[model samples]
Target: MDGIEDGAQPKKKKGMVMTIAAIAIVSVVGAGGGWFLGGMLAPEPLSSDEARVLEEAKATIKAREAAEAAHEAAPAGGEHGDAKKDDKDGLPKASTEANGVLQLDPITTNLSYPTENWIRLELALLFQGKPDVAMAEQIHDDVAAYLRTVSLQQIEGPRGFQYLRDDIQERVDLRSEGRVTNVIFRTFVVQ
Candidate 1:
């Protein structure tokens, strides 16, 4: 009786192990097929406008970085015997508008609900015609104000973030009165 029980145990264990191996093999094959099909289906052609926009966004970021570096290097004292510095105004000297694209300075703010958490965002705008610096500034201020009111959880997950972007875009559209065409979110980080 003991020998028969031990023999049956081995058969049961062998069957279970074989079933697991079969399931793993099936899963791997199914995943491989899905990956191949997804790649084949994902081939997309870029339009001329998209290409131009990507180039413009790159240029805007470079210009912004250059301006920030220049701003930092110059001495603060205007009354010095040295030649008076340019851009006495607070705004950075970077070219904010170029090739129908407008880049605004980065915005950093603390969330209202969770005062500890902070958000930093960088943005670029694509205008209908030429970029409007004044309206862009207005939009920046509006975004800062809106961000101050947002709770940390409001922009927690992917869906929450999508909603946040849509809300901001809608606000910009209304404030710009359609002069501003599209809002390009360059960077978003919450810490």
Candidate 2:
């Protein structure tokens, strides 16, 4: 029994030494492989020429941004380079000619039939000569009142809408006394 116990102790010591040796060899191999891969994947340093080019690119971007900012700050006008093109109100000048057709504010009113349904309309008046803002307003009011009397059935289809336009134009002619040439319908929406 004594001999058998001594033999078992030496066997355990030998197994432990073998495990330690195996672990050390594997660690050394792993470290060498990692070092080799890292060297191969390392980036090359940038040259002086490449660094100068990068600086130039950044400067160009900054210059372009400054130019765009200046352009946006400038007032709107007739032409891009014309400094005197901007109007007194700083708003973009209208492209319309003298005594040209003038657009008025939109008119909203409920239809006579289907009183719940509301209609919106935008109008432009073609003047025979100089546009009178006062007369234009009066015509706009008359048109709004006239639209209120129109039933949904009266302005249902294209034909009905044509009738409405003609009626409105005729009314404008009578009110303007040959001053207004035509009544142009810009937009119409029903809700």
The lDDT leader among the candidates is: 1
TM-score of 1: 0.52
Model 2 — TM-score against the truth? 0.51
85: Cα error in model 2, Å: 12
Alpha-carbon lDDT of model 2:
0.80
Q: Candidate 1 at 148: error in angstroms?
A: 0.3
Tens digits of per-residue lDDT for model 2, 15-59: 999999999999999999999999886645559997787578668
Colliding residue pairs in candidate 2: none
Candidate 1 on 38-103: residue-level lDDT in tens? 988673555899678757866876797798789779667666433433243333324434356777
Instruction: Supply the global lDDT for candidate 1.
Output: 0.82
At residue 110, candidate 2 shows an lDDT of 87
Q: What's the true lDDT of residue 17 in model 2? A: 99
Off by over 4 Å in 1: 1-98
In model 1, the worst 10-residue window by lDDT is 84-93
Specify the poorest-scoring 10-residue window by lDDT in model 2: 84-93
